[model samples]
Target: MDMERRTLLGLAAGAGMALSVTGARAQTIADGGRAGPADPTEIIRLWPDGTPGGEGVTVTPIVPERSTDPAFHDRYAQYTTDPILTVFRPERPNGSAMLLIPGGGYRWAVLDKEGYDVARVFAASGTTCFVLRYRLPADGWAAGADAPLQDAQRAIRLIRSRAADYGVDPKKIGVLGASAGGHLAGLASARTDAAYAATDAADALSLRPDLTVLMYPVATMADPYVHAGSRTHLLGETPSPERIAAYSLERMDWRGAAPVFLLHALDDASVPVENSLQLLTTLKAAAVPTEVHLFQEGSHGFGIRLIQGRPAQVWPDLVRAWAARLDFPL
Candidate 1:
């Protein structure tokens, strides 16, 4: 193996061993009942000097809100005052990477299903994955709707800055997000400038993702199809028209935005499939390379599990093929 690949694999192995010693449990898969790869190589805080607008904020232990449901226990994770990026390195280094952002309506982050489970799938396919546990806007942790976007931008920049250490090509880095996390990813893709003022050297790097994948995302803050909970959580109960327009992904400038792959189920009532469709239209109009799949019955939040046995479960393969088409080294 090349030295770069060897260094990454060695780091991955060490991370697994360290997780074992630290008593961090492996994430459980959705359908197969298998476990996720060992805990991440490292959990780097998004802001080591304390997050902006996070003064006097205290962290509470993450408690599964729907503890009675096995699915919830398997998928949900909450209460994150200190946002971080959990690095999951692949055994086979492909010089590509993705930063995953989980969704909980901007109220909490779904660390297991949308984060770890998805990470395992991509990592297994040779892409190093970093699962971002971003700060929630509902927690009043940051100033405005830009808090999540700030974290997303920082995560991308940090990954790019440390790409060599992780055997990743900075140019091949992408961002994937689900639900509200998808909104954050889309926003980050369109707005690459640092949302918050530069606090350190990492901020000097570009936040633009090379590509983007958004699954069942809340694409717009407008009504008729808006996920009310997500909109309210991210922008407060009474968001101004200007704020709503600014956060709407469809309205953002698409200049220099990365190629995108979007997947959503038409029957999704929670987020509405129109979210993806609207964004697809905008992307197409802007002449951005974009591909979209609207499933007939996969509902919502299906992560990497099989949904109705066929097309839904095949999204990962589609994503792989898409990445290959883009020559992303995956």
Candidate 2:
């Protein structure tokens, strides 16, 4: 009868389709088909062997709430392939690996423009690239606080576990995120909070990234400046004050954080530049290895697109140079 109900009903219907049901009337029925190994709690197979048999890499559809929420499925349907990673070690290869997290306000992952495109550049620069299709927020289930972080941590550990196979230097793994993904990246680099039980062998590997790259990140949990959507989606309607403190990267100690590179636009509108400024200041004050690039003019969520008159487009090159300075094989 009302907007909320309508939205909920629509979401339910979408969820049904995601679960292989035809319409809104029928309940979800398991096909008893086993999908490949992923986070059994989060990801679902939309097109198990890539999309309709077009193979570049195996891509999976990731849902927010145990892979059952229709609203999340509907939003995820808009994204075809997020291309988790691309390795470009042809000859004289290096062992560095990087995970790229795309930004879409925690609603959807902007996989193509941000994830794959950026990965291509980094891969050219001798770093193995992983374009992540991380779980989105807004449907509870540790959304704002832990879900994305878990995805990143798992990805890092997974890469580390397969380092020899992928020809990656296990100790040189890095993470880069854009917009809300940048927030996730920062949290991944900052928080030592463990999400999964240390049952498996991969659990022994640390999730802390060696280096972090933030492109217009939503860096805080405090009000006014914090992206309310990300906060509400992550913490839910009634998050405790302690949870807020826990998620704020600026408030946390920078000693344990990895080397961080922050790129932001001074004239952006959606997310203020102060987010970068505050985090950079804190990193500097704490003597954390940090680099900040404040572009003259560029809006939020630009996703590697070049502006007509601004030097913001040169970020990839700058980032490549920075990566070169890390002393890993290039």
Candidate 3:
């Protein structure tokens, strides 16, 4: 079933024709009144009036396009001026929710491999999920590096404000991020201040996640183990020392933060295992309940991606168990 879905990118916007190139089953696209968590929903804008700092940003070409990289055949949503959430509901409500953040090195949002596919897996376990389509910093948002977190914080508040609508117990809400998205998740968890000014009542709800799950994330923006592409995209080509220090999330404050679950592959060439290790160390110092697993293989961006005989494929269950131990069961 997963294999079939991979080949089929929902709604071929370029051709403006059939939902898929091969007529495979398209993922459902319902909206607010949908009766159940198992069904997926259409996009919901985080800012109905207008996204702050994105007032003049050009937002055309919004439909998700297939990845051009031959080796990484998936879809990415770019030029996203209207940062929003795509819902993936559970077949049975577990009274919990997660704001799902995918990664494309902060250049775009990978919708399938890191999002829809993974969300369905958790939703099947009765956890309602919302996949975030955040604004990219390089796209000229005035907030610069803070744009993604703005979208993230807003998404979390949205979920909390509409908890009953989604059948979620607001207290059980958390975050799950991958690669660069993981960095944003970690930032969201540690932040004691709002990323953006209050736009509505939802802003009053806590933006810090009840829990955090980072999958081979871009942990440090500092020194040796930095994911250069992510750093450049978020902080520009030659960011100042202050900027570097600020975004190096592992070294940042984790006060009042939620417990975290870290997953990475020792052989992850793109985002080195040290990223997770550094975060683990800080989390321990901060006394935030933390769990970590460094698999010998399965490298980076393995978002529930089943590599035959590889241990990273078990990440979803690992996350499930960790959350359950914290009493925020998935």
Best by lDDT: 3
lDDT of 3 by residue, 1-330 (tens): 133443333333222321211122342222223222222434556887677896557645344545454333356777777676877777798999989999999988887788877888898899989998888998888898999999999999989999998899999999999999999999889987898999889999988889999989998998899999999999999999899999997889896689899988888999989899988888888999988988999877878644546767788888999889888879
What pairs collide in candidate 2?
15-70, 84-131, 85-130, 95-169, 144-234
Question: Model 1 Cα displacement at 132 (Å)?
Answer: 0.4
lDDT, candidate 1, 1-330, per-residue tens: 123433443464554321111112232222322233445545666777767887645655353434344343354555455567878888898999999998889878877778888888898889999999777776666566777888899989999999999999989999999999999999989985678999888888888999999999999999888899999999889999998888899888887789999999988989999999888889988888998888888888888753637578889888889889999855
TM-score comparison, 1 vs 2, better candidate? 1
Off by over 4 Å in 2: 1-92, 140-144, 306-309
**Winner by lDDT between candidate 3 and candidate 1:** 3
Residues 97-138 of candidate 2 have per-residue lDDT tens digits of 888887777767765456656765666656777767655444
Provide the lowest-lDDT 10-residue window in model 3: 15-24
lDDT of each: 0.79, 0.64, 0.79
Between candidates 1 and 2, the one scoring higher on lDDT is: 1
Question: What C-alpha lDDT does candidate 1 achieve relative to the native structure?
Answer: 0.79
Candidate ranking (lDDT, best to worst): 3, 1, 2
TM-score, candidate 2, is 0.72
